[model samples]
Target: MERETLHRYRDIIPDFDAFLQAIRSERITAVRWNPHKVSRARLIEELEECFECVEEVKWYEHAFRLGYEEKPGKTLHHILGHYYIQEESAMVAALVLNPRKHAVVLDMCAAPGGKTTQLSALMENTGTIIANDKAIPRLKSLVANVSRLACLNVSITWNDATKIQAKECFDYVLVDAPCTAEGNLQERITLMPRRMRESLSRLQRNLLAKACELVKPKGIVVYCTCTFAPEENERVVSSILERYNVKLEPLKLKVPHAKGIESFGREQYGCEMRKTARIYPHHLNSGGAYIAKLKKRG
Candidate 1:
């Protein structure tokens, strides 16, 4: 991690040393049980024989925190669509969205389909989910995960999400926009260039705007990112609120989290930006993530 990047989060993140240490430490393995394929109790019973540990996430009944050595993916249960390997914090977006059964949903940038599959599971495979992504190669993995997870209701599309020509088309929309991956330090990835970060934020703003356009009036759009940068998280959301008739809704998850940054440097975001949730690695002993729930006004 660069000193400059670390400095940006120093004040905004409480216990900065702990935050740094947490990211530098080993990443926790977590997975959400696929209710479409198996019951949580049954999955646990099956996994108990293979792995030394299988513990349920207290707040999320379908999610479980696996022991460090457990490779949930290697098991036959996973091959049979028993569960999906996902970060603990990353699961919050779909849970907060709480899509109704048979609702039409759009997962903008749905490559690798973690949340899209979660949305399918939440909807009980009854609703339509347009799982669209721009990258063709990544979309292949998305399709595979959707198939392996037995997500029957998702229709995969390859396109620029911001260019989608639809209005009031979906009951719910999720803009899990592409970000700098600042929060995914578990992978030990390099810091992205400033230009790349700026470009991503621009794309994020456009995708979010399109999401607002596609969702029905009074519908919900849940914006999330696996990055801690305010530019990509709160600022992108702040700009959307300025252009759209939408209000930030409180995320009522029970996981430990910090409130979003209202201002970074001299730029002050909307007061409602505080309603967004920021989860640091130290907060949940998992990878960092940001989630903001928005409801379109009638």
Candidate 2:
């Protein structure tokens, strides 16, 4: 945990050990992302310095390059498909989901195509990816992004994840299920609806069940969320473990210049928690997020 974050949370949990212990217990609390240095200009500056993907200038400007010279977000994302403008936290889910190049995968709630597109990149444009979303309009966006990225292996579906029950159809499944957006309150302030708190848990339960059903036996199923609620995070995960024949896969998340997030969920929640990773804002210089890797057991 970051010092600032610990300071903000010291009243509730005294030290890093205590904070983690609490998380292991599944006591609902807010997590802080570190460095907190996600300015639009900073992201652009970093992207520009990297020469590997020069074609991404258009994506840089359109998707999220807030520091465009003029007319930011006009048609640049469409023109180049240089990269997908996605939430920094959201990317963690895909990386941790750890798709192999030849693995058949399913992204249950792929829309605006962030994770779907990233999977394409991870697979180096190989294998089959079935990206499904509930909204027809969003599916179109996913299609456009996939097409623009020149990924021929991806297929888009506009249907609720709950209804799709292809048994053992994929080597892996990513359920970046929708949540209350509590972890994003600091960034996406548009989460102004209070009524959603009551309904979000139920929705998550529905999504988790469906995701577990679609995953193949002995395959990996990753459950991720951008919220900090236990009902949505640890509780949903535990419920799945209890209700289904699945086990948690602890993720030692790795990225360039990225530190690993610790698992406090094991002891705190009265369940096997190490199989999943929980990230908070104070853990690193990014947004608050909770990620758990669950694999179907024999």
Candidate 3:
């Protein structure tokens, strides 16, 4: 991306060289969308998944324009489910959530069922996961995804992740709250960084409260976002601390290589920030992400 774009956020310190390398490594062609699939509904859905609706569509077409390259989904990774075509770094939330067998987990905002399915895998398919999203249309996709994943421990529910009942019941809740997604700017620059500040802050608190509210006494809540802005990530964690006695959970990331892990804080949420981890595109071959593990102190 652009330096001006990277300078605004604390997490991003992009290396254009590496960026180029990543692009070169990508299996998907950088083409625009296929003309045949350009309906309003399809466009909107892909936009949500890709975030960079216009450019991504263009890139899809651009890729197609180059030639009839094989789609990534049709590859072995999709069959193995080793890697998923998720909302970019959205997978981080599930990794951060880390559900255990016999636990009751709820993925608030679980439509498209990415995190929910992951949680099922994490729990060894022994725990229960209530996957909830408000949109009926999106719910169908969620159901389809969970079914495709063969997730036996999941139950599909149609409810707004924020306003639903079921307080203090879940052993763990992954509130990967909706935000303006500044980290997503590499693709969605049309949505500016400054404009995302307010939305990020607001959703942070709402997500924290909702997640904290549902966590069983002494249960853990992992809050995450794709955006790197501290106002959203840490401030949201801080807000949760102000309202409840919560402690940050340390993230043990052994797979992907990370850098400058110490650069972020320990107590931004009113306690030491030792138990949290944040990853940027610069840190590893991953999209930008902020992850914090919060335990309800009760």
lDDT of 2 at 283: 43
Overall lDDT per candidate, in order of appearance: 0.88, 0.62, 0.61
Pairwise lDDT winner, candidates 1 and 2:
1
lDDT of 1 by residue, 1-298 (tens): 3434555678899889888888888777888889989887899998787788878778888887777854668889988989889989899999888999999999998999999999999899997999999999999999999999989999999999989987998999999989988888754545677788789999999999999999999999999998888888988999999989999998787999999988988889967888999999998788889999999999
Give lDDT: candidate 1, residue 62.
86
lDDT tens per residue, model 2, 1-298: 2112223223322244633443333222211111112334544554556422322222112233223123222334325554444544566787777788888999999887877887777787778999989988887888887787777778888888887756777888998888876555442223424346447767777788887888789888888877655556777777778899888876776522212222233424544654556565444323457788888886
TM-score to native of every candidate shown = 0.96, 0.70, 0.70
- In TM-score terms, candidate 2 sits at 0.70
Regions more than 4 Å wrong, model 1: 1-3, 187-190
Residues 78-105, candidate 3, lDDT per residue (tens digit)? Answer: 3433333544345556766778888999
Quality of model 3 by C-alpha lDDT:
0.61
Judging by lDDT, tell me the better candidate of 1 and 3: 1
Better of 1 and 3 by TM-score: 1
**Best model number under lDDT:** 1
> In candidate 3, which residue ranges exceed 4 Å CA deviation?
1-4, 10-70, 75-83, 86-89, 187-196, 255-271
Q: Count residue pairs with overlapping backbones in model 1.
A: 0
Q: Using TM-score as the measure, which candidate wins?
A: 1
